[model samples]
Target: MPHPPKELYTIADASERWGVTTDIIEDYLRSGKLQASVHLPRKMMHKYTRQPTECSFSDEVDVFDVDSCDPYSYMPQQGVFNLCYEDVNWDEAGKATLEKGGLYLSRPDDEEKCYYGFDEDFVLSRDKVYVSISELTRFEGEYGTTPRTEQQDCPEKVVKVSQDANPELHPKEKESLLKIVIAIAIGFYEFDPAKKKSPIANKITNLVYDLGLSIDVDTVRKWLKEAAEIVPRKKHKITPELLSDFGIPPHAKDD
Candidate 1:
């Protein structure tokens, strides 16, 4: 058997050698089908070296002969869905089981399932895949064992706001303020203290001052109360009176 070539080529070299355009190489990179490393220029080599050396190098150089999988290429005719595998239906579970080593999609069935797969391959339902980080954390709390990272712990400052000794706002306002505090604590956004010229802004400024946050209370309050709504609480434990009110007959509780 003849020995394979040991010399590695830059993307430019490979492009010239293969008679392909640089765009093709870039496509391969974006698709994650190819791996490349960058090469830096050395002053000594640029000034002192006499013999013609390969000058053009890529910030990203491709590494050949490694096993690479393109999620798009093997993706079923579905979309990319992020979900816990355990939640999928039996048929989908079977398909995922088959593609356990690599990315794969579940087979479609009558039951509801989240559609997800790389590129065209999908799990086969209009189910939403991506979720906000906060939701993922909540899921972790409910499931006990989360497949993803939990929401980061709140800072002491926010904790203090939640435990305000003298809350100078309504329940809804306080709730909004708490959310804003959390947003600020998580470094998502900041309140501008100088922009508190409106009545709503003034209210927020008062709340911020009360909470000991040196932020423009008005701005913070505006963001906190903006689009705020009360979420309806869920009823899990039903009383006998509630059941009777629903017309389920008194004997049904015993059964």
Candidate 2:
């Protein structure tokens, strides 16, 4: 039942508040890390379909015309193949009458007054969240709802998210990283501050400082502790799709 806000925010709104360019916010938005208030069109009057069972329809009487029992309805000699529950046979009514393949698929029920339409294909991603805030501006949400079969683009991004969620790490690499992270906390590759420091830990620490990435030891411990307690990850087969999520296209998925 969640609906888009009455007012939406724009890229400029986010940019001005953070004092950063829209490009930065754009990345966050695409990654789903930031909740962007984009204008998601709702073709409403709305309604997917389920194969029908039972004839408990409320008062449409006159029922099936005596000579017109649908064969598909399975009543000895009832409804024809593809005869819709409400006695509609798109084949007979013709596609143009129903506006077949229209952006929104609409249909009528018992009362005929309570008409309905399918939501815009891309509208499934809306889940409006609200926090105590001031102004609201417009957002440009997605409008593409083509099915995966119809879509001639990348497949679903099923690559597993990582503990660190590094955009740089190939998706499969997270399995290795998870092991290492947990290993550090559990003392398997012990980062002993008392005894000799782990060469691996030192190298990584040096790498962080060398890259000018500043973080506290407490934060490192916190992440390691969390990683250690996580449900152990199973070995993942590396694939081109996994590679693509990490921002490196290997062309393996081209086939």
- Winner by TM-score: 2
Candidate 1 Cα deviation (angstroms), residue 212: 34
Clashes of each: 17, 10
Q: Which digits, one per residue and each the tens of the lDDT, describe model 2 over residues 18-42?
A: 4557666556555544543322233
Mark the regions of model 1 whose C-alpha exceeds 4 Å error after superposition: 1-76, 81-104, 107-138, 144-153, 158-163, 166-255
Minimum summed lDDT over a 10-residue window in model 2 is located at: 74-83
Backbone-clash count (model 2): 10
lDDT score for residue 65 of model 1: 21
* Candidate 1: tens digits of C-alpha lDDT, residues 2-89: 9864344444544444355756644543453443322222211100111223446533443222122423323223222233333334
